[model samples]
Target chain A: MGNIPSGINTPEILVDVEKLERNIARVAQRVSSQGLKLRPHAKTHKMLEVADRQLTAGAAGLTVATVGEALNFALHGVPKLFIAYPLWINESQAERILELMKRAKLSIGTDSVAAVQQMAKMLGEKAPKVKLMIEIDSGHHRSGVAPAQAVEIADAARDAGLRVHGVFTFPGHSYAPNAIDEAVNQEHKALAEAACLLRKAGHQVKRISGGSTPTAELSDNSVLTEVRPGVYVFGDAQQFELGRTGWNDIALSVASTVISRHEGSADIPRRIVVDAGSKVLGSDRPAWASGYGRVMECPEASITALSEHHATIDWPEERELPGYGEQLRIIPNHVCVAVNLVDSVLAIHPDGAVERWDVNARGLNY
Target chain B: MGNIPSGINTPEILVDVEKLERNIARVAQRVSSQGLKLRPHAKTHKMLEVADRQLTAGAAGLTVATVGEALNFALHGVPKLFIAYPLWINESQAERILELMKRAKLSIGTDSVAAVQQMAKMLGEKAPKVKLMIEIDSGHHRSGVAPAQAVEIADAARDAGLRVHGVFTFPGHSYAPNAIDEAVNQEHKALAEAACLLRKAGHQVKRISGGSTPTAELSDNSVLTEVRPGVYVFGDAQQFELGRTGWNDIALSVASTVISRHEGSADIPRRIVVDAGSKVLGSDRPAWASGYGRVMECPEASITALSEHHATIDWPEERELPGYGEQLRIIPNHVCVAVNLVDSVLAIHPDGAVERWDVNARGLNY
Candidate 1:
């Protein structure tokens, strides 16, 4: 279990340690040199080892998508953490958040007055008022209050005696190819508007945060003090599709063995079925993706379809297909979701020796 | 966590221990009463506990999608296991298959001569030859050899001194609502044709395995000797959309809390955002699905969109939405993938006691 033996079985998620380190270093260096703090999203890797590398590479703190993720990172001694997600504050979550705050310097996100009020009730003379960041809907329309409403929420936080840290927005629309620039522009506009609104409302908008993997490359660091780019560390098919990164930048792949072959036929040409299917590789083929996932070796070929246990790969007529049992690495469309699906990832060194890292944060869905 | 605590969080996956037991019993009873052997697929739960229940419910064996899954069940002492997937035979898988054969009766699926030949080479001089199941493409067209070509692979398996046990196909196309009947009919035709072809080729086709959750409900057991239905134990959105099961039959859900609220504007109506997103709930919204998933309490509403950490839920006009931090349960579109994303599932008893079972087969991708 220490070193993933070579020819490691099918549907196994393999991470090239060398490439991963390089990917981490590349992002860390870019963010640090820009004088902006890098709070790499732990939601991507969900692995203690990868998070450690991000911290080692000069990350100011870590960003987690859930309280459970925050707890896992805290357990690994990640000192400063941001629960980037706008959590719903409940009695159970309040208890968990209070306990987590005691263990680490934590900041939580919220977009509603009710949430802040609930947080105030939970804090109630214990451990001081928690820091809160107002989430603004910057074109994603997924979460967050409107920029106009940000001031109201910030005021509510202040009224609740909670420390208002900053404003945050996720330009998740950036995931679409050719939408990165628009997303970054939207991020800047939303954060600027929200910051102005908060300031007008007599609150200090100290930290203006925005940036997804796609927009991070073109982010306006002047308006935003921090950028949370999760997937940059291990570029995925989404990043590639969005023109944010090249295939060479993809640092992770699910290594799988070809288990079945359909020779050239009149109707269907050469096709190979791999052991990696929806169960392992995930069934996340975004509307923009060429297929469910891209084959690393045969980039032209897409995973046409996936059964629960078999990846149906249709190769081009001109391309030579690998024989049955041949192992091929696949770059998944969405790296974060794929990472979350597995228990552990094979961390392979430059010399090809592989180390196994437990996905300690594998299932922190609570 | 031995007993799931009361108010055991919203949007949390709860496996009704009783319902799950009933589902197991019902399926097992059908198999037994019909005089057909039951080989429950472990890909759905990926839990040893669930597999144990299947066995205890009179399952003749267990069916798995991967060698890794097969190994997991075998380790848990399930002596008979079928790797129902058309596996690509590699050196590592071959070695593992040989080892698995030592502890459990192993049946593997293949669709190519190359795979059969490779497996044959790997099983050379083994105590017992691995049983082979020729996968026939019964209109699912995802994987499996052509029904007419089943004998080619069956003959190859026999020539390799492997036990050509039977033929198998996944009526995966039945997952779509309109295609269920057609897929089931095609499955019967394919199985019948393959069985006849194998028998005519001087091979005994003892098993005719075909059935997915959608087709299992109306499957003609008279034609097939065995039925492999994985998702029936915990019905998912696919089953519901396919009209295979009602919402009451869904056994698992992700408990999420409403984190944010937005008042209606001229352009947009009132909305509530939940903490559960694609990462936890999985981004699987088939065209027929109401939304990304079904809300347990508010079945009328639909989750409009999902960012990595946010689920944007739209409500009808003037409806009182759940307050921020109010817990809500979500039934994901695909339960199998959602379960695979998490490490452990919280099994909730009727009395509100929660037991955490190790997803022993959680990341057995290979």
Candidate 2:
């Protein structure tokens, strides 16, 4: 609709403000209307500005993946922070968590009893203040204790003087083709049983947290008090391919320029190289993800392959292809990993002006 | 072989200095014995310390992938830097290159005539001083012009007042399973023909650069003036799988701590979850690569899957699985991508001391 900044760099992250606001409001409305607390995961954008906007839109708190990520948000005065993924609290991380706990209400996820014990010993007397949520396996089977085993871990956490929160699980298996509804059911069943176990153990199960972008809409919110979907705020190609969101719902993409064009032989498709590659767009092609990333304008083109600095998009024989220096918006397969690949994002306002936001919590995997 | 730093952070990059030195020496000696210059690519580690070590080990110059990377090395007083990438010269990047050119002798890759014209116009009078390497297709077909068409682009570069030095081709296709020898032959043929084309046009073909870690040793130096191998100094799982290096050659790995251990059913292998995942190790499996990465000590444990913050490793029945708090060294599938994912790398000295070296050129895709 308008010209980008003349001096803008290629292979850069760009967020359409209008679309971003719409996506945020839409998710928040659905969660709030269902009477569930919305704690959008910060691992997607890793920007404090995005967190602030979500908080402004009635997010209960922010959910992160690591202690370093939580520290980034805590430094910016986000009072309530939750490290949703199960973490093995080491000395450096525990010390950092101690500093963060003094500034904010912190919560962490633990899957194993030994990890809970180590966390308690690492934090010493301050462990009680930090809320602990036992992650239960909701059929994903990646990380998280079984629903039947949640009571033992919760009891052990309480014995170690840790504040036991309810239970949480990531319905990651929802990402597979035609598996969203089943994953949602599994998440609900897992959290419900895990919370029941905590309640039977005489512990207050206040938060039965569960979600993922694909299953957030299909989730049985009655069984959970909160939903934590990270990718819904900035829909990616994986979300689009799964029919979880429409193309209009995609807010973030890498603004890439056509760097080279190679004429293919009769048997091969015409190879069009773009500046954006794995380094900028991230290589997260889950079998179903539409060809690395979708070219927003050129739907007919299939991105055949990608190297570190070049994306080889095979253009249809009939469709007109872009020449060198032409720019394209690439909706990456996984927006979270793509955002982590950049230092900052260019947010283009409705008025067409752009502002760069620092990816503050980026590379905070520790 | 020794104790890891207990107080250090998890999901961190660790470089064994002794192993790293050995790798550097090995490649340097091989390249030197051939009477061909070695310009190690900085995209692998992107650290000043690594670049310094490479230069001290008799590397003629350093090769980088982007202008932002070149600027990082130039600022550190590296006398010569070659950006072996077909960069789309934008206004901001051109301005940055102008500043870098003032600091170091700069050479860049160009495959198209339009790109050459744009680069020449950006540099203006100083364009003649910048050596231009015409990229030729060597079966990879990712980027670069065909070997037969190299003279047209080289002549166009010369007409635009750019110093047409020679030709270069990346045998990137060598990374595939059992494709190294074929890719090497392709690279040699492409560079030889392209250099011959340039020389026929009365241009002095002083340099013929070609290499990739997989085909570096197999490369015919009689047809090439120099080799640019980036991953040799930090052998990854992909390189090891291709038989280019051994486990002992893998000097860098993500020092990740076990966060969770899930007991699997009879059918499923025992799952060991670590804090390091795609974010720390990078999402570059290349289909044929060893599942995500490899656990150095637990060779029988294969990393089955990786989410943003968790690496789900499948420990074979015969192997002894790790405990909840034990640490493992994860040699990533692609060391370059893994190094770029971090802010700094931990250099573990022989004396048991560790120092963090900043990944200065990380996220410098522009």
Candidate 3:
């Protein structure tokens, strides 16, 4: 709505610092008031600045998806970190994790006995240095052992001389439309059952972790000691479509220019093509998602198609179409994947000065 | 499948050198024999080594999607470069283009008269230093003027003292099932009509560039002076699904490890989760695509879903599922986007030696 900042190139991510802080504070406050630990997933922003904001808002620690991400945070002196993924740790990765443990309290997730045994074999005597969280399959069914199998994995970790700290699950199925309540319920039941099983098996299950952005607000604190919600820091189109966050709450957007515009005729609809496409905005359109992404200015407009560097937006008939070279802010379908595509994001500070935040863990998928 | 090489981590791209060379050679021979110059799009691999191979294989130049990509190749001493996207150049970009033109012959695509006028004003006396290509909409309609509007934009560029190179159109509609022939026809007709209109308007149209991976093999060389195909070097699942490439033709794949596996029960279907997800393989699934990606070793296996770092694969019933820590090669839905996701790719040489090829133009989307 305002002037697109000069010197900021098209198809670049711009983080609204004010909105980001609000998003952070709001979630932190909610989690804290509910008496649950907030360990915001660093995979979303991957920026030290965003992690700092979350930490400053009283996050217990940072949850990472890979050892590379964990090392990125730990090297920056983040005191506590967790790799919340069932990692099949290789010899080289084991060495990195050992080095990482020296800087921070590192923990990783494991769902299988073989993975734990391999982690132990790779880490050897240093296995106890890294704690393990047995992943539980709530209902999302992507990864994690069944609730009954939590004891088996915990026993395997214990037999491998690793510390079984707790259990964790990712209620990713909550992302679908009208599935939030079911996902929350399953997450609660799974974590509760897994914790009970581990306790009965003579293991101290102190930490129970679960929560995606859609199910974060409705997390059962009675079962979950902490929640890891990454996308809450920068709401995406998925969260918006799932009615988790409103348009005003979306903090991250791609600043792109209209490169081409076609006024509608009787046969074809009016549309404007923007420079930002899957390369910058990402192509993570779920079946429930409205489009590839959303136009911040025109909420009803749908980005019907996207090429590598071109997004074709079906312009609403009632509104005047933007001309060539006109800049528009676009909310990506998935902020995490979009953020991972670029080296850095332009963070617009509260004072209107733009600062570059390096995506320190940009492509650290391994 | 052979052993997954040591030292290479999971969820990483592996480019088979022998297959890559063969793929490159085949395409080069086909295009050269047709009497059309080959300008391979660097957006596919984005590796200088791959570009060098393409150049050595008789490619006339490299076509890029952005000014940054053009600069990347130019700095690496690539003799000729073309930014084939309709760029809305700002002052900063104009400065970069001027600097870029000093190192190599540069041409850019423009669909609007306003864009050409702005280019002229931005470059001023140096406008002629760069060439302009009028992009015609050949039914894809993402960006580009209609065939009839080519003369208007060409006239604007010519009046502004810019050299009108020719007309180019991307037949992106060729990416669908049973649509390759129609796309080729539309591309030929559109380019021919646009070239005719431009010639009648007293402009020397030397180059008529058009061709995507799907339509490249069937391109009408009589009307096309040069053809640009990005994904021919490294076939992806999309190309495989479109019947444009066979499984053996795919030169690039993501080396992923199975982190979790589940056998089918009465209700739930069997699936395995790999480390390669949207963050690595990229989430570029068209509705017509079978799945998120494909397992190279198991062609029938479908990557049913993808999280940021987990790909849930639906393994075939006949095949024995890969165990945890077992590595698998995964072909992404789109090779270009997958290549852009990482900083480097592991190029498996003909001698079986692995080399790291830096994606020098990885995130040069701006």
Candidate 4:
């Protein structure tokens, strides 16, 4: 896509149409050719247009992080959705899921036997059948049960009158540098083990799915039937730093104006302050991740720190820093977090026309 | 207020009426007794009801961070407003500010002579007189000009036919563990010096304001004519750790459900995973902050880490960890950010009635 004009609002997410289409097609082709289903995560973009494009590009379904996101997509006529979170089925959520099941084929992740039993009780007799996936631990140490324990939860869901649809896990450790290979290995082993255990327990394991953006290339397609990657459509600074992608693959960036430029000593590193801060880019600096974000134009320049509404950048000494009112595109460390910060984004098409796309599922954590 | 009913929603902000009233009255009394104007930052709650309470409690005006926030407050019938950020005055922002001035008395912050000149150009012929304040650097080193240079911009604004309204600064560096005293001293020195310079330049300094939540109590009221402290209304983990607030002063928290509880090994601490994550609490962990947020029921229990939709809490060994489906209140690291994360908050009244209050200016980042 062409460069964004300065007429629109600053500190806004800008989608480059050409790069987005290419990124969508690329991931879709790779996953489809490997005989694996492409179910791109809706938590990344959450825009109906982007979801339409992914579905049109051979995605089998959409993966969401919350029930509200699933509802948002279902309302827009997405046929299939999987809420890939170990969610607590509260009364309101269970009732909403019952309504959502009428619109789309609903699948949810469950890590506990107690939650599955509660969901079953809430669903009662008249509810439609819903698929359940056991969340298996893939060495992320965040959530999910051990691979050996996955069959127990899957069995519990099946016993409670829910359809068991196999297992899934997140390779969250892959976000760090030098950890992609290890995370990929963990994903393959955990998924394979979970599938084997579930099948032995008399459950028909149809969908054994696990894949993050960085580990997708090394994913064991032989055992997996589906791949879910969110950030591949919008390559962030974290992915770029891990050598998972280059600048050309970046489809989305935050367009920020240089509100103030600071003169600094050598120790401080000459800097410029942009309007985009933690409120826009998000405060998600993993200890292993360097800087806040990478500048799209000059990857050498790093967003050193962030206040509420100001991003302080440590510019390179070799080049001149931007002046007041100069706009720059910033690739945030986490695209999922950055996309949630704004209500809508300015899409700069290849032909230079701009359109707005609302983040329909933003702030839908409940 | 009573404990949040489990029937509402998870990862939602809950406001306690009893504590909220106390916090508001306490700040209003302290600022009024000291002969300083209490214009608490509206960027914290962004709710009209909270602004109404603050105004009724004895606030002179409301302080906002952006033009959008200013307009939001103005439309809510707040008589006076101040945009306490060195904002870039684009044509659209200028038009909005001009429209807002018709509804309320408005003032804006400016740091650079270039920006002030540009503002004068866009706001030239037909616009009414708007107050302009020069932002003085009070050791934050983020935005604002030097204390000595404040007079130059104040003079330029005056020459450009705008009403010159003194100087202000933010002690943002006060968020660290032991830096409150130094930051308070810096705020006093900078605001006092800037006022003196403006007076020396034959300009009347009506509003010499500077105070963050941490430094609000330690401010030298003799030097400050007004103070703007946002997070005081909803005390957060950062304030509680810095000894700026007591546990009783915390009026707002996120109600999250324990989705899964994990048994730990030697390296992994005993943990419970909550549904409230960075998307709800916001990812604003300062290096000095102990954890992502604090458990309201057990302040010692720290949120060890966070995913996009899950807060992993490492509970204290001595205390019992919450099991699945337990609803717990979470005090985030930064209240300002957490407030911006949600569209509406569940306000628990003194009579134990819970009502929804819309965050009117949630994403007014522009």
Q: What's the residue-level lDDT of A139 in candidate 3?
A: 88
Provide the overall lDDT of each model, using Cα atoms, as 2-decimal numbers: 0.79, 0.86, 0.90, 0.85
Model 3 steric clash pairs: none
Q: Please estimate how well model 2 matches the true structure, expressed as its whole-model Cα lDDT.
A: 0.86
Rank order by lDDT, top first? 3, 2, 4, 1
Q: Report the Cα lDDT for candidate 4.
A: 0.85
Candidate 1 chain A lowest-lDDT run of ten: A1-10
lDDT of candidate 4 over B234-310, digit per residue (tens): 88888999999898889999898998887777865678898989999988887888999899888788788899899
Better of 2 and 3 by lDDT: 3
Error of 1 at B25 (Å): 3.7
Stretches > 4 Å off in candidate 3: A1-3, B1-3
Q: Give the lowest summed-lDDT range of ten residues in model 4 chain B.
A: B124-133
* DockQ for the candidates, in order: 0.59, 0.74, 0.79, 0.66
lDDT of each residue in A67-162, candidate 2, tens digit only? 888989999999999999788877878889999988889899988889889988889989888888889989887898888998889889878888
Please list the residue runs of candidate 4 whose C-alpha ends up more than 4 Å from where it truly belongs after superposition. Answer: A126-128, A265-269, B126-128, B266-268
Model 2 C-alpha lDDT per residue in residues B189-266, reported as the tens digit of each score: 888888887788788888999977887766557899899999999899999988998988789988888888866887
RMSD of 1: 2.9
Where does candidate 4 clash, by residue pair?
none
User: Tens-digit lDDT track for model 3 on A59-123?
Assistant: 99999999999999999989999999999988888888889988999889999999999999999
How accurate locally is residue B264 in candidate 2, as Cα lDDT from 0 to 100? Answer: 84
Per-model C-alpha RMSD: 2.9, 1.6, 1.3, 1.7
Q: Ten consecutive residues with minimal summed lDDT in candidate 3 chain A?
A: A1-10
